[model samples]
Target: MLPMEEKFIYTDEEKERSEQILTELQDTLGQSFLENDLPKLRNHLSRSIAANAIRRNVFGLNPILCALQTAAIAVKDIGLKRDSVLAILLHQSVQDGNLTLEEIDSRFGEGVSKIIHGLIRIRMLYQKTPVIESENFRNLLLSFAEDMRVILIMIADRVNLMRQIRDVENKEAQRSVSEEASYLYAPLAHKLGLYQLKSELEDLSLKYLEHDAYYLIKDKLNATKAARDAYISSFITPVSEHLKAAGLKFHIKGRTKSIHSIWQKMKKQKCGFEGIYDLFAIRIILDSPADKEKMQCWQAYSIVTDMYQPNPKRLRDWLSVPKSNGYECLHITVLGPDKKWVEVQIRTERMDEIAEHGLAAHWRYKGVKAEGGMDDWLASIRAALEAGDNLEVMDQFKSDLYEKEIYVFTPKGDLLKFPKGVTVLDFAYHIHSKIGNQCVGGKINGKNVSFRTELHSGDTVEILTSTTQKPKQEWLNICKSSRAKAKIRLALKETQVKDGLYAKELLERRFKNKKIDIEEATMGHLLRKMGFKEVSEFYKQIAEEKLDPNYIIEEYQKVYNHDHNLNQPKEAESAENFEFENPSTEFLKKNDDVLVIDQNLKGLDFSLAKCCHPIYGDPVFGFVTVSGGIKIHRCDCPNAPEMRKRFGYRIVKARWSGKGTSQYAITLRVIGNDDIGIVSNISNIISKDEKIVMRSINIDSHDGLFSGNLVVLLDDNSKLNMLIKKLRTVKGVKEVVRI
Candidate 1:
């Protein structure tokens, strides 16, 4: 700890305020904690402030002061443990303060330092946007799972920052902060079961995001507070008396809903402020022992129903099996005076704390138990992070975080929760990857169903598996879960590896039989010439029969013959030495860049004929046109025979002596059945090939049939053929041909 003179220069009033906050924090942590390390902790706090002041100008209150206040709030308000509180106080220092990680570790223990490190890394990850933002957010959740304390501190820190956001002067900064709080942090808080923090964050964010609407809702809520309180008093009076008569010790309070929630209700229901119902809720806090908690909750439910007619569908019983986030309560909407619906929540004091403080309260009161506790929730998050790092995994993480969950049961009566719209295959993968890979079908509720059948709440599903069953490439399009897709990809890659090895062995045997003695270096050059990036890719293409073995042998022979001729004597060559069947083809000239006509057509310009769009490797001849310029045409051009008969003397021999290094514009015609996502699927395949550039695509569909035209820029004919082969594999595509 630093000396007293080096401490933060706080005014007398600020010092008093800090002391008061520290005292409250110590009191909440209890006297036993104060006796052990409170003094040392307090010294560390002062030294942190001093270190921060030296490196940066202390703001009006300074982040250190704000952090301490937030830590105190976490303890007294959120019921977090000592480790979490310490993490909150020091989290900012890890990134912004003069203190380093080693210094923090020396001051505090390793556990606190580790949590701080994780928090800093998560914050850094959050700074990335758009491309990898979702991936980073999923990583943030995984970090939270590694240590629940990190998220607890983050929630506390966000709550404090939101409360103080009004002091920020920049409007754009305020908007950015408010949007992040509303879209990311508030939903996270709600998912963690911290209703109080969630509501506060939402309300604060709304105040900044929609200034006019927030003020209107705020004014209306304030105006109706008096009348609403009277109505609540009159409504609960009879129920209170009945509970008293039944000898049930409980506390009933009128809880006014937050302004943001009321506004959300108005918008969602398409109603005005006056038309909104359930603006306030009544919470019944019962005092019951641990053994009688569930029984007492149901008993209270029965009593409430006796006093008023309850809407059966509006009832939710979480006491029997608390929510995955450790929320336990019984909620019911009862018809009250003037046919108004009054929402009532019944829970014990312990349940109330957990509901308000969320995971922090769970850790504080229940400890870290493995079953249906915080540990279990953490394990699920960890499993999701371990699944894979891809767009599919990010989608799964977001679905798990934000989507409504449905609870189902197994044949053994064990309850399981999955995101809504999950299918039987997702369930199988959730059980085990091997089970999912080998799953042939499933029986939902004792009736056979397809693997794509969507699961619903309370459905018991049993996956049928076969030993010979294997995952198909089409399964990637059917499964919705990230784990299933990842496992399938891994299995397919392994199979490809094995097939590639066998193809390589076959190729080597063929080479040995031919006495070619093809070495690895020679093979590398051959594969590169064929536009293959890897030897395995070349072998895989061979094994898939996409490349013909005869073509490979011919190409290898060409290379061998070229090398053999290079060792022999050189031969004189000239354009006039070439022989042709027709005497008129005698004066042909060769050009490295473009075709050159004979001296007879010397002054004539030459251009490729568009009729055939002849490329470098095609057999070609030149024609003297009416404009007196030589025009090149492929031997197979549709007009070649007519031109040959019409003007035989005008034809001139032409050949390309060097390779063309330019992209050629080409058009392809695709016909297929109209299907969803087919265009996007085709686009994905095209964009994935680095050598292929798609210039434009047009599609027309009618009566279940679709025809598409694609204009692309490509290097050579081989790439065009490879692209056509890939496009044929897209679902619903029937035929692909180049026009």
Candidate 2:
């Protein structure tokens, strides 16, 4: 977030300042004995000071100074931990390749490494690119999921740069960083309760953006500084004396309003800076015990109101009831010495810290805290990503989520969103059931983990699959979302049905081979003996190999023998109820004199449909015509749809039962080069096959290509296909298709 270009050179004074910062940091975070012990806090500090000007960021800001200022804010203002501070200090080192994340992980801890990694990634996102797409901005928001501390630290870094940019010379980087601070960092600070820092960021932004207006406001404030100081001093004397009389330990200060606030007031009131009253407020932060915080604040309010007339409409007693964001103060606007309206705020030390520190203060002073912001932060980011491009969207992003959600990425960087508690299996199913069924586990952020690992907000997931892996009943327990559960159920059901079919086929084949005919009721009894209430379950066990097919067959033989006398033969079952190797073979079963599947037909006049000429060996069906004659058509014939729907009552089961004695015409549209003797080659090929005869050859030639409908008489479809294949092999024959 560096703004404007600056020289790489560091002044001697700046080096001393960095060393002083290092000293200050060590006191904040406890000291380390040596260079290699426990984050090596002092050791890293020494290196950072040495490496100050040696490394500069994209905006050419010195890394050492930026880190020092950012870490100072993080520790003093936000109450962050050593890990966060370490990340702030080491982010630039990691970015410049002078340090590795693994080294940080080993030296400090994983927490520090993760924070630095997030900062490094954010830096890389904008390092080479000036134009930030909406997607990248979205990634920036979601990156907080890696570590919300990153967000806090970046705001600190931006503030440091904004303060220094006035001396830098670059115009474009300055404007860019200024606009970001205005729209992005400023609002974020306000949300986090870093009000003082928030004002600083925006006022600096105003300086960069509205240069003339900023200086004008500054000049006015400067001209009245003496009088303003005298007034503030006069206001404080009475409050201080009253608090001291009450035996209260407190300090009071008057703050001049930020330039941005004054500018906004000027715009709203339609007046210049002089006309904008209430330019500053006085804050009375008390050092009160936890139990007496509220009482002491109310007492201070009473003292203030006694000295000056309080405005009833302007009094805000937040101490009675804190805001949802946990702001507690007693604010009063009173008529002061010169009939000027002055705002005064009273709060305890704890309350002030909570107010100044933003998210961390409430979380820390309240109780044990989570490193990541709760679901509200996630919900807000999701809403902003979905909402139109407005910084206010991110500003107000902290809304509670109706349904908790997590966003993940595919190996290819395709983003996917899922509800909270969704697992790796859920993500796989979200992609496809095929992947889900085959998924064994996955690699999250390149670390191999189980399929049951729950996803977080910013996870990069690459699903791992095995060809042999399949959905199991236990998978239902692992599933979170109903969609994944439903998919797993469906896959399991399909596999069961398939297994049942295989078992049924195997049983039928066994029964046929052994010449055993059993009733459906008898098979039901066998299934019950196998501990299955349903016949489908029996077959499932068989397919799963829990119940061997051979064992089931043996049990069947014993049951058959027990039910009937072995000496007497039983009547064979009807072929219609039989299970053949396959349907096509049963229908096309051949015999000595003819193909021998009985159609159970008497003498009926049958003719092939002229629309789709049916040949022998083709799967054909019989449709009785309106005139009582039968029309034999291929199962996939064009006219079959009309025939079946319009005249379904007249249809009958049919198949070829004998060799075709009658020849039928089949046309082949052949396209090829207009080569001499090509026509003779086609005709000769058809004549050489004694079973097929060329009935007609009609060729049309245009521009070296000859196309013709060659009609031939053939009794079998297989023979026709063979002739087509043979003609294709002929030179100059480019295309041949059945018409």
Candidate 3:
């Protein structure tokens, strides 16, 4: 359930959109590619779109276009390679089950597959959760520290998503996506020195979260355009003239601050829009040699400082020691015309590109050198991350106070890295494919432990394997790394294929023993009649023992006699048996229905969504599902906003009908002090109400607080409220909420 996936509505629209993106991809190539590579590139794009043919992402946008746009940013704005672009494009195809990593490796290369592997490794972090857990976030940082390109591609992808979400009707999704953008993507962009993208992400996030505040600042800035432009011209003209006269090759440009930054300033300073001064900054990008870049920047800084009074505290010089991401700049705030403050940034073209494109541009510069390449930087990061067992000792990464990963040493003293919460089974798989297939258990730090035993960093690990032991389906959940999971999947698939061959041999023997003539037509009819689409599936079922050998032989005999005149099987359309009559004013008026689901969707039936049960007299909306049924979800349902944003065309306004006469099951979460008999007290209140059926109650006490889920059957929202009020009156019951 990453956004823009699932619930595929139309195939033709996807094809049309894919064709458009393919053109854009060709355009993106232009003259930067070899003529001989065009056919291969076309073949790759064709295969990619074919795999992701029916999928959409980012509020009902084509996922292929989503990737194409991100690749465009990575190439045009971030200066990434074709490999990075291919990773971004084909990663979704692999994730959506349409393609495989092995296929990518065979068709493209191991390099592209590696980057896609990194992308999928950390794909779970983008779920629609209120807050990312501390441990998960740290693991994410570890993943980012492993591959800086993943961070850049993800930032680019998020930027593409933020720009497209404005037309989405789901405000809740917008707010959540906007908030995550503000919290994670913006900071990562800033840290990577993608200042322009960082500011744009911040502004878009503000537009989604605080609509009024964003527009208010935007309006103020718009209203003061004349005066602001005059002042900027006055400041830049003088600076430009002085720089030119001083024999410096440079150009100066001034612009207003981002609306988000201005709004933030207004809040932090506790002032109105006009109260914030220094609302803009002027950038001086110098065209200088790679060697004279610093000297020229200082010379330009001197010319500006001499004209305006420089504030000592506002001076920042990073020319001597560039940021880790290779951002080099000199910043200063000075008193300008009319005693107003103005911020100034001075850097060379190379420095500016590094600041604009972040690590990718830095990589471009360092690609010419021999030492401290991207691989070396990542190796150093991995070493630092794995160097500590106690994160408290590491003074840096306060937000990630404790690195939630563990590093263990092999018996030969070789070091390996693993995220925290992984077990010895994962370690075995990381060692070798054969070892994982035969892994039984392991001894950690000279202490024998089960395959499920969690290992800590700095501990020596020894893996135990038996040739007879084989992988089981349950082992899939035991391993955490993508490589281990993929190996297990491959091993299981190989076993299944072997088992299928064995089953086929058994079937042929049975047919020969029964003296029955075997024909391909007979097998096809028998397979279809037995509810299997593929002949391999029929054999696979027999291997798994879901299909009986005797049953298959009997069915084949029956099909051979009757299936000759039968046409090939065609899928049946499921027509729902129900009615949605016009809403009565009596039922409708009681709810004050703004959303009246008056018409029955042509052939689809509707049901209340179980995630958020829509009780009688509750506000609701209809969502068309892939199952050809409409799910009625509460207006306030957590997933409602996402549904609206993604499939707005399929959304139907709904209201509860008064004709309903049913007791809906709702789960209520009750929290209070862990007093004696608190659970008993709550249960008694539910039991006392003869109208309300007390379904079940599960209680847990933690840190002197009582928290429990109380499942109860109620008639409607009114009764739900009454029961909640009664529960609140109980001793030690502090809060009650329907979930």
Candidate 2 lDDT over residue span 274-391, tens digit each: 6665686999999999999998998999999999999898888888988666778888888888877788989988888665455434333333232234424543332332242232
Task: State the lDDT of candidate 1 residue by residue for 1-739, as single tens digits.
Answer: 3454655566787678777887787777764252546666667667765554423122234565677778875665456656666777666666766568887677666766777887885665444231222222332354333455566567777788777767666678778778777766775565455667878999999999998989998998788779878889988898889888888889998877888988888899999877665776999999988888898888889999988899898888888877776779898998877677889999998888665454534333322222223333533433332342221122222213323455455665455666668888888888988898888889997899998998865567889998888777898888776777888888788878888988988888887787778755666656544545567767876787655566687667655665557435557543222111111111122322455466433435677676565655667899989888778988988899999998999999886654555565556778998877677677657656767765556567899998867766665667877898999999999999765
Candidate 1, superposed: residue stretches over 4 Å from native: 1-13, 26-61, 81-83, 130-139, 142-145, 243-253, 283-335, 338-340, 345-375, 378-739
Candidate 3 on 526-556: residue-level lDDT in tens? 5543335566766776786655687678767
Global lDDT of each model? 0.68, 0.72, 0.71
The candidate 3 region of ten consecutive residues with least summed lDDT is: 575-584
Ranking by lDDT: 2, 3, 1
- Deviation from truth (RMSD, Å), model 3: 35.0
Model 1: lowest-lDDT 10 consecutive positions: 578-587
* Model 2 / residue 471 / CA error / Å: 30
Ranking 1 against 2 by lDDT, winner: 2
Which residues of candidate 2, in runs, are more than 4 Å off? Answer: 1-17, 32-55, 58-60, 79-82, 124-145, 236-254, 282-332, 344-739
On the 0 to 100 scale, the lDDT of residue 47 in model 3 is 67
Model 2 TM-score on a 0 to 1 scale: 0.44
Angstrom error at residue 96, model 2: 3.5
